[model samples]
Target chain A: MKRVRMRRLKVEKRTNPSAWTVFCISLVSILLAFVVIGFIFLGFGINPLEAYLEIIIETVGNSYGLSQIVWQSIPLLLCGVGLLLAFKTSFWNIGAEGQLLMGATAATWVALFSPLPEPFLIPAAFILGFAGGAVWGLLSTSLRSRFGINEVITTLMMNYIASNIVLYLIHGPWKGETMRGFAYTDQFPESVWLPTIGMSDIHWPTLLLGLFAAVCVFFILNRTRLGYEVKVVGQSPKAARYAGISYFKTIFYVMVISGGLAGLAGAGEVLGVHHMLRHSDQVSLGYGYTAIIVAWLARGNPLIVILTSLLFGAIYVAGDVLQLSFNLPFQIVNVFTGLILFFLISSDTLLKHKLSFRKGE
Target chain B: MKKAVLFALCLVFLLTGAIGLQAQDKLKVGFIYVGPIGDMGWTHAHEVARRIVEDTFPWVETVYQESVPEAKVEGVIDRMVRRERCAVVFTTSFGFWEGTVAAAKKYPDTIFAHCSGFMRAPNLATYMADFYQIYYLNGLMAGALTKSNKVGYVGAFPIPEVKRHINAFTMGVREVNPKAEVHVRWIEAWFDPAKAKEATNSLIDAGCDVFAFTEDSDTVVQVAAENRMPVFGHYSPMYNSAPDYVVSGQLVHWENFYLDFLSKVHAGYYTSKNLENVDYWDLLKEGSVEVGAKFGMPVNPKWKSRLGKTYDLVMERIAQMSDFQMVFDPFTGPIYSRKGAVVVPVGVRANYGHLLSLEYAVKGVVGSWPGEPK
Candidate 1:
């Protein structure tokens, strides 16, 4: 009893982190990111506390600002949820931007040229948008499945072609007669325009659609048999094949769902936000690309994507706030966002392992 | 759980109270830009004017969001009007036309002015400098200085605004040196330096000794300087960037118009109700559009007299307008399209409607439309 044996401690990896540990790690990572960004604020001759306060006051403090945050989050939510499904299946679909554009183009065509009634036109636009995006998504899936081509290259290249198609249409046949030779199409009729809630920019229908999509995706990935097959194929393709899962069919289905979701985002942007098809930059604003970061930060969780997308949306609103209040350049917002993402990814390693001191063996 | 709920409620109250304290009595003026303010080109020019506005009006507070995409302009406008309480908003991009118009309709109490566009409403007024006047002067210098007789123009887009500039420059080139031809290239972007440099090099390879560009960077001037060729700057002065190659270029002076417009707003002469049908297409006569230099011309020392004479002629013609006689109009008659059809007949000066909607290249231009065969 008097001679107590000395015990040795060891650092070891955890097969899985507890929910409480995951939550604490995320909070700590975000706090550490803010501390680092505070140093940047000081370097810019701005008080860190004041800068953060201004961002909060401008973005989430008022109803108008909150509406803007929600407005910006709609596209991100759709794209992020879509990418969540694609990444879950281990199908690297980098053509969300191209798919988004094709969807907007299709929706715009239906809104402007379709002879359908007001009641039918809106639904038809959504359907056509989904079809357009699905086709674009299938292009890369087919190339990957049929020819074993890397999807990253084909998808990235498709973005340019899709953008050029929009440019050609706006500059040629679809150009508005009264636009004075501008590079934009005519506005959609009021009937096709997504009705907003009260006077705010909150397009409730699209917002509800985004929320519904996240729930549906979560159910598909967690509760459905197809989801079980997808997880198996993603984890171990050889085992999935032994279990009689067709790799081709899984890839096709996942790509279709992913592309369809992105296409719906495009339709929302055109019908709900811009009310017309303009330049690719104006329509998407790199939301499709930004969704990649959103999906990764959410760890492929469709439910988590809602919060992550709103976080990014807050960052965008903060950018405008920084410009308006601090008189800072827009690039400062980029640096801030880049720092947050950097810290979040770096802290990911902490979730898998814990450091402990070891006594002499 | 009760403690957590109480803490959340307290935090919300604190945030709302803190936000309420930020209201001020200052008259906020908001600006929306389509490009970065540090581009040293179009946005920079507007930023410079904004500085003047800030310095001139002590009571007015200025706020701006740069690189606001065209589609998102309406949202920014709404934020400015509703959240920031901005009474007057300036959207400084042609692509923001639709958003500005829609915002004007939505916020009838706020005054909206769109730059480089043609749409106007009761609360929405449009303003633009007569850039073609300066481009024509630059063309005169390019025409007189070039030895290869092949000039190059790197345009940003096929829009009517840019098309008019290209046509005017061609007219100036052919006016002095009839043999000089202006070859055109479209980069399809306004601010891509790499593409601008590539386009400039391609034109240089195509035997263009003198160059003019409508892009939003100094890449063309830098490329021409590297090659020891002559070029003209667009939007801002590029003499410091390329001392040897840049002879003369268009320098947009938005300060005069901005000061004038803001003064009117401050004086209560220009408001939402009176702003309808108000379009400020300021020309060289109004001092809104001028030669590059602050007081006089920024003509290169070598060609000062030759270019100075044309500048004097333009000013003289403006003065002579009070007497109802037009002498040195850039779009004056006998203008021919690239297809050999006379677009502006002899003894007829092109009016604002025709110039604003220019669709075809002039006879001396050596490029076709986007879908046309070269």
Candidate 2:
């Protein structure tokens, strides 16, 4: 009777993680990270206190800045949702960046090369982008299932290959002769662009679309047959197989959904902020990689990806603010981001037990 | 453990602080380089200029970051101004124009100089190398040299900088041989050797014996030399890359202009008024530009004299020149956009406003502008 009571208590405790508690812990961790960032200022011959204040104010102080933050968060949310899907099924899709590139590639090809008219073109671009990403994802899935290769390495490698393919095309066969030596295809026609909501600085369509995706993922994960199988498979593949779940089928489904979401993100980015694909300024920002951290921080919950992506988006914007206003090396921003991701991922320890203090022998 | 980590980090901070403090009295100038200093192209030219500043001015101090992205450049400029307290900050990318403007607006007391941009503020000044005119001369040389009259060009991004270079070269090509058709390939990245080689290969395959490119790597010249084709290079003399094949180059001499600017700023004689009008020309006689230093002997000996006369005539014409202006009106009539639109009239030059905020390609170049779809 006592043993049964203890087991029940353990289960209850395991299921009862308060969101506020996690939020506070993360806040403290971020504050600690800032203290480390302060030391970076001493090297640059600036007051750390003043630099910190400037970063905070510039990133979040006013409406315009806030708008910029929201704009940056859209890609993160889209990518984070994709990350969440793959991670839930134990497939580490590290190629969200590549998937995003391929999506842009397909969308641009449709926008420029295809003769599809008006409303049909915009949807077609998104669909083609999704299909492009799915194809990329399928490559990894097949490699993992058939050859027993690691999906992570294959996916990451594919990103480079896909990017290079697009690079070659834009500069070669697709390039206009009159614009000789310029590395780009023709500009995307205006008729095929995604429509933005009424003069709002933030893209409401993307935000709403992301929210809708989250709801769909939430229902699929918690209320569908596939969701239960994914959970079981992620926890223990041997048990999942015993329970009649085909590993190959599960991997294929997870990758398709994952890549599709990432593709949607690429479409959103080109449609939302950049408008066209400029290969020069695209990759260095690491929006795709940051989404991995966002998904991890949110504990792979589709609903929580929004908050986590925004938090990361805030860091990205604040890092830029800190670098510009403080004259700090942009590398320092990478360091802080790396530290925050490290702490956030490691904080999973809290799910098991509380840290306790003991006397030395 | 915490104390040790903190102490080590603090030591690093102090060391950096000492360096920063030492920079102030020395006429501190911060340069935001867009590529690695080792890149033989764009950033290399700037670094050479920075070195010239250091060599010429004993009191001037320069700090820089190589391989910085456009999105993060604002932070570096901010730090240079507010933290390092640099008297002058030079942002060296067209994309950095907005960031520099924001910085100049926010800190009106500091001087901000941008390369290849048009944004102007009381404290902000714009400057560019004007390589297009020189490239036009090279195009003339290639036009005279090529037996087939098929010229190839390899460029980076399709920004106005690259576009103007190609367009000017094309005009020069047509000036010499109206039948000469220029073939161009753009490798998106600035300094990848493999892509550069591939682009060279593609152009070569397309029957272009004369090659020119705006790439930052030496691979273009190397590939040209290997394939035994005459190639015009961009940024710095490419004699070292390929003495046999390189005929002309558009070199950037940043030192002379950089030294002049720094000396004035250092002496406190620099004003927004003076800086705004400080558009110094990079010409052959000014030690900032040199052309045809590596133009090799042609396979046909009889054709050499004619090429020499053409070169001499071009030199004479450029000698009478003050600035390399865009003569071709891409937006005018008689010009066909790649999309078949009769955009510009034949006679009028594209005005500064349209050229600066160019959103579309003048009918020949394929691809979207800065913010178009795929």
In terms of lDDT, the poorest run of 10 residues in model 2 chain B is B294-303
For every candidate in turn, the CA RMSD to the true structure comes to 3.5, 10.0
- Candidate 2 ranges beyond 4 A from true positions: A1-94, A101-228, A234-277, A280-361, B1-21, B272-287, B294-308, B322-374
lDDT by residue for model 1 (B130-163), tens: 7887788778778887789999999988888888
User: What is the DockQ (computed on Cα atoms) for candidate 1?
Assistant: 0.55
- Candidate 2 residue B264 C-alpha distance from true site, Å: 3.2
Candidate 1 local distance difference test against the native: 0.83
TM-score: model 2 vs. ground truth: 0.63
Q: Could you list the chain B TM-scores for each candidate?
A: 0.90, 0.81
Clashing pairs in 1: B122-B276
Total clashing pairs for each candidate: 1, 21
Model 1 spans > 4 angstroms off: A1-10, A357-361, B1-26, B293-295, B304-326, B371-374
Lowest summed lDDT window (length 10), candidate 1 chain A: A1-10
